[model samples]
Target: MIDWARLQGVYGPAHDVPTLLQAAGNGAKEAWDELWIQLWHQGNTCDAGIAALPALASLAQHTNRAVRFPAIELAGEIVGAGLREGRPLEKMKELHQPVAMLSALADGWLSERPAGYRVCFRAKLALDGFPVLSDVLDDFLDFCCDVSCPQCSDKVSIVIGDFGCYSSIRDWNLGDVHPIPLRPAAPDDLQDAAQGLHHAAIRDEQPRLAWGLRHVFGDAECGTCDTAFSVLSALEAKRSPSTEFQENAGAATAPAGHDEGKNRHWPAPPF
Candidate 1:
């Protein structure tokens, strides 16, 4: 039993998750829109979405193609995709999760659930069509969010706008705002995390994230801007994955520009 309360969605505590999911199953338009906002957030990733994926994946058999495809794509991206360059493909495989999930999504609807050991792919599931969009670098670069750096994600519009330190990005940036009093792992903890966040923005082109860091940058008293920049500079000092992503950037999760947030919402099924 997963503790849904422990997770955070783009808007608030992941309220209405089960309900929204149910509504999605029923082909509710508002449900799909909210789901997209909660899961991807203007094209950026959301941890809440990642956590719920295993649950959402079950809806693969849903009659609504929008529901099925988005669920598959979102879940697939987290298990090893989205930002495309994420460590999941290697990380989850090392942990062992995708195959079964994919197998189920691919064939679960066709027949009885495969046995515990017999859950082989009756047919290969191709993720190519779902293209995870978080890998693009320029998407995170520029923004109109000179107002703030995302300290809180209070949606001032139909969807969330770029407000730093105020929102979430489940699968996009390096510096996450979860756990309130955020901390680092080890070694170059702050720097590495900072670098990772900045690099993800610049490298992935997650402009909202990029500008969020810029928001943090403007907070001189916080001293995070200089720190993040120093980390970025050091990262630049040494050629690494950031370079690789830059040289061969792929699809952007969000569109580039001010407050555009790379808006991507699922369309309703045609009657």
Candidate 2:
């Protein structure tokens, strides 16, 4: 069984949440292994499940971003898997309090250091998955709306679009806080595109020309011209099956001749 006494002992009055989270991140596998061992021996019970909540939540706010990111991710995984097993929803509800607390911490991190894109991104991701934390949602959306940098704004737009579409179930109000229009592409657009192509080429080992086409035209073959030709050229000599490529294959793809004016207040596209 989990050594409740040991966990409580480690959580003695002197050790703060941040410290414990750091420890958990540095030794997550070990810590989680212990937790699982305890859970397996103790049997699945409400109290036992609830007791693990605090430690897991603490890890979500670890000082090390690497540790904190995975901890938050793991919490989501555990809750999702546990819920599927017919576990009591109330036990999962108990986890919300801590998750919300971590969300607030993430908000603080973003506010204090706006350049920490990774932190802001992960925070948005966490809040998107945990709708019960309405307060965190409010703060995060507000931050996205107010942040002036295009990169930051893009991230915000992406998060707002994603949450608005998937998590909030078409509830645009969830994205009401920031109402900034997307900035027009500047001369830097080509540079940014080239850079994106370079990164993709490096990561996927595709030809520069093919990568460019895939980045630009995607699956929409220009009716007048072979858009696929351009994409294939960017790929250089590399050849891959196009079986998975479909016209407008992913939600990220813009609809052909899409009318933006149709919606009175269209939420911006998630980047």
Best candidate (score: TM-score): 1
TM-score of 1: 0.36
Q: State candidate 2's TM-score.
A: 0.31
Task: Point out the worst 10-residue segment of candidate 2 by lDDT.
Answer: 162-171
Task: Tell me the lDDT of candidate 2.
Answer: 0.35
Estimated TM-score for each candidate: 0.36, 0.31
Which sections of candidate 1 miss by over 4 Å?
Answer: 63-66, 80-99, 103-271
Worst 10 residues of 1 by lDDT: 117-126
Instruction: Pick the lDDT winner.
Output: 1
What are the per-residue Cα lDDT tens digits for candidate 1 across 1-271? 6567777776778766777888887767798778777766543455566666656657765676666655655554444333332435334442235435653464433233333211111121123111221222233322111111122322110011222222222223432223111111232333533444444335543345444344332221112221212212222223233234344333222322223334523221121
lDDT (C-alpha) at residue 135 in model 2? 13
Cα miss at 96, model 1 (Å)? 4.6
